[model samples]
Target: MSDRRILPSQLERMVYETIRDEIVSGALRPGEQLVEGRLAAELGVSKTPVREALIRLQRDGLVEIAPYRGARVIVPVDDDIAEITELRVCLETFIARDIAARRPTDVLEALETSIAGSCKALADRAEEQFVDRLSDFSDILAEACGNKRMKKILGDLRSVLHFIGNSSRRIQGRAARSIAQHEAILEAIKAGDPDAAAEATAVHIRSIAEDCRKAQVPNGDGRLPGPAANAPRAKARTRARANR
Candidate 1:
């Protein structure tokens, strides 16, 4: 990638967001080294801003910084996926229940709009847009529940969840299934059925977790399987050897 300089005042936050988006979009694959100098050059910023961004990414659990080894994308293992899945199930189910009981018209309308956008994206085979809309759908429901703290927690988890979802949804039929699940949850909420909404949310999360598990790729050594094997880094390696 070419250098893209950030303005002085926006350096830190912009650098962090840029790198985070790259990681989430799989442009920076898992386990790929994030060299300070290289990222600085590519981002057209000084090493200082890049260093600060790496620290923030590390804090977000998206990167791991070693003392002398620099930073690398943290590969999401099965355990990591499972833990995130459980947390989402707990928080989102509660949010669904609350939203269902409250029955906020504005929130419902926002969710419907998101679902409609998602359907259009899927029909067009626009994977990125589809996932973005799905995330928006979840965020609207969570915000509607009116728990600021819970909403903040969910926001904190959004990047990693999106990364996982992007990987899992690549599987055949997974994206369609997810849309159906979201529809079910929305239907329950529209009907003012808290219990049904909660159940639907739980089921959706569990299904996503299962799909993520199936999408995991075995590690290079055929041990310690992780999601990294499915990443671009692995494909690059395969191509490198094939051309030899």
Candidate 2:
């Protein structure tokens, strides 16, 4: 752990982003322990900021801290993902429809570039690059809609979804399919077919959500039995608690 002086705000942001990225990348899987002492040492910051940032993340739906137990990475279940996908379908479909009707040339071009980058990253098996490019595609669609409320909502939702397990692992030939979907959406927008574009966007998000759900454990139920020697200890508190 490197020790360096940092402002209060910077420390908090740094802690938040570090933990968030770890969760998003699945480096910290669901239900994994987040020991304050360990994290503070790793980040070279006092536990105060780390604790505060964790509380903020809990509010943001990224972590769950139970009483007497430490924070644990959250994994959305099938139901949770379905609801999220439905919300995304509604929001993004509307954006696609609007973009199609308005035909923003620059936005379309930006989306094309993102799709190309995403395809290349997928081919190279670069997970970070693929995620970044996919994000850019979403950003372009939201910006094209010209709705501040929609943009903020989508951005926040994207953050939450980032923590979900990646489905890219199962999609053996997903890059080509993803590119085709994007091309279809873009073509519809270019042709000024709002209805088709909206439908296409809805289908795309649904497919991604389904893939993510498949990667998760059955129904997202993630409980493990305690060690044989600790069976008695488990009877008292089956669930973990927040740390002091």
Candidate 3:
């Protein structure tokens, strides 16, 4: 005796999650255009739901829409990345301090479970799941942060940071290093050392920005400096020719 009808709001939320996940996972890519008619046809829904979902995405900071230009994924420039990194460092460091002072046992257990899953995913070389594990790990920290508004702020930034995090994973030796960093932060939290935990959180978040910088490719993905990024390599190639 359950209602089997799909509500319009339900449909919109589903479309929102699908598109958001696609964007976050890099399938949609930064600055990729989102066409309403096309997406509606593809999702077998009407344009209304797609349009509404897009507005919600815009509210989430995941998309930018113009009156006529349509919608595109938000592309984070280097300055955007730096500003976001600093903000996260501050917020997460504060969360670490709060959690350390409180030392909630349930939160600690949840973090332990998340870390175990991440470790296993890494061991099995499951790249996609590993990124999800990273999100879960951050979520656990956000939940334990002792402020609802702070948790929401972190959650709002999660997708953007998640994309940047996946970009960071492309760096050589970064995965192991990331796992180690997460552990360091957790260990400090467990020890109830607020200063240690805060420092670890700051360092871990900062490392992500560094890794993302190292992982940027020239003229691709909008990380910038890309226009002239190849000049040095080109110059090196020219030097080899001159030597010959």
Candidate 4:
């Protein structure tokens, strides 16, 4: 059997995907500095690929690079969140309508499976799994929507929204509500009611936007609160300790 080893370019892409997932999953937190050396050490690669990976992430609008200051995760501003929400409302509503109109058996089954998984995750208090499965449900709809361009656009928008969603789900009662909303959308789709599916999708997107807004930092800086604000300072302290 041939060795199934990753190539250098593939390794760089792997690093990029790993970091991007962490950011979207909220494990990295917004505004956190991405130290190349640390990531390189953790991933068992040279700093070169890590640096390249950061550059790739920067191009994807997930990281910000500064001259001589290294890279940091890009925190979604209020306008960024607002614009993404609006776009998602428009695009995802259309996607839901398309899926409902088509009612492909395979796609509908996938969505149903995702919804069931999401419910179980929520019931079990598996927050991370619930979020992932919920996104999977939407992704299924998007993919089956029969519009490649819209799918690509929604995918990009959802990456940013995923971060906000990770924060929004932390609010009391939010996860249960989201699960119910997803079920509504799925039911509408199963009924092959385009209008109902679109309406359900719109409601769900609006609720998510509202929850994210409520969770926004109150410091007038339009940034995510809590860990996002503290991450930079925490990184600085870690660096100081390392130097000492």
Candidate 5:
């Protein structure tokens, strides 16, 4: 047997994980500028790996790069939340129904484990771990629904969720409330009630959206637009117009 050594190939991946963790943990604030040279210096590496890692983050939708202004952590706006919520409600409600009807044993066990992990994280006040496990509930259902496309789409959506989850957790009682909602979805799944599970998932998603919107605060460079500012523009359909 030969001993394995850390290769140059692994540096990029290592750098990527470190930066991604900082981003997701809110150690690196949203919309914070990512300077490659500084990151390389902090990680004790050259700029090459740092640059590569940032490109990966950009692909994950966690970072945004400009032509000359450099890269910054994504600060999701209200529109982003609304769009994500709508998509998740549509996709996950379907997943909840499908997975509930099928009731795959392995998937059920995974859901149970996720719930337990989240519960422990909540008691310990481990916000990062709590969010990871809580997010897993939707992810597990997405995977078990037998739709690869949906799974990948939801996976990509997890990037913006880290910021939202961190914000939502700071709101009083939200952590416990989220756990209860997850339990509701899981209980409905266990009882083999597709409609109940689906409805539960829809309710869970909508409530989270509402909470995230409330939790956002003003930042240094900008503010996440409030619901009033981000309201979806709807075409007027007045009765007077109908008379035409």
Candidate 6:
């Protein structure tokens, strides 16, 4: 990639995309500070565009801007994550049902392709890409549902969840299990079984939610506990809702 400083408009676009991608991909982990000067230098751009980009990212709930701390990635609280996952389960299950009812062969093929990629990502132990690829798969499903309102809602929900932190690495075999679920959904869709697809998708999301519940808690803790460990999660959720 070119390290050259871009023009004003290009710089703005690049800065936004770069920071957003880093945040979503988990390249910049949640709670990691975003040093404007360093980022500008790294991207070979001036701090002006970098600052603007940070503001934009803040609005997108991808970064938190504090008086002394500047900008940092947002991490979602247990409740917020749980809520988002619940919303996703509802929306995605509906999508699977609608798509299966319609029997869209092309969309099913696309989802299968995404599932294949997700399986490979899991096999390679690439958590970041795995989550992102899975998100793409989800987008396809939502789009295939043929409901604009649902798509918009799911898109906004995804933006909030992405900022919270990539949760794909929560369990060892979670990714593969997700892929299997996708396959099951695809099969249901192929069979023109809307009810079965919806059931499978809901089960898949619930399984992930269970895994996240485990991952978010420490070894011994069953539920989210302690103000100390929970502080970051609370802050992230507040920032996310505020930004939205």
Per-candidate Cα lDDT values, in order, are 0.79, 0.71, 0.77, 0.76, 0.76, 0.70
Q: Model 1 over residues 1-244: C-alpha lDDT tens digits? A: 9765545546677677778877776667667899999877666667897899899999888999998898998777889988999999999999999999988999889989998999999899776677689889898887776788998999899888877776676457887898899999999999999999999999998888787676666457753233321244434334322322
Highest-lDDT candidate:
1
TM-score winner, 2 or 3: 2
lDDT of 6 by residue, 167-198 (tens): 44445666668778878888988899989999
Q: What does candidate 5's lDDT look like per residue over 1-244, in tens digits?
A: 7956556667677778678767766666667899999877667778898899899999887899999999998876789778878888898899999988988899999999999999998788675577779878877887787888888887777766655666555456777888899999999999999999989988888787887767666646565423211111121112112222
Q: 116-234 in candidate 3: lDDT tens per residue?
A: 88899889877667777867878888877668888888878887788777667667777788889889999999999999999998998889888777656545655432221112333
Better of 1 and 2 by lDDT: 1
What lDDT would candidate 1 get against the real structure?
0.79
Task: Show pairs that collide, candidate 1.
Answer: none
Q: After superposition, how far is residue 40 of candidate 4 from its true place, in Å?
A: 1.9
Arrange candidates by lDDT, descending: 1, 3, 4, 5, 2, 6
lDDT accuracy of residue 16 in candidate 2: 79
TM-score, candidate number 6: 0.75
The alpha-carbon deviation from the true structure for residue 166 of candidate 1, after best TM-score superposition, in angstroms, is 1.7
* Model 4 lDDT per residue over 1-244, tens place: 9977667777776667677777766667678899999887766667888899899888777789999999998866778778878888899899888888889999988987988998898788675577779889778888787788988887766667777776676456777788889889989988999999999999998898787777665556754555311123334334433432
Supply candidate 2's per-residue lDDT for 107.
88
In model 1, what lDDT does residue 180 have?
91
lDDT of 2 by residue, 52-164 (tens): 97898898787899999889877667787888888888898999989998887798789889988988987886767876786687778887778899988988776676554
Using lDDT as the yardstick, the better of models 1 and 5 is 1
Q: Give the residue spans of candidate 5 off by over 4 A.
A: 1-5, 219-244
Candidate 6: list runs displaced more than 4 Å. 1-7, 124-133, 161-165, 213-244
For candidate 1, which ten residues in a row score worst on lDDT? 223-232
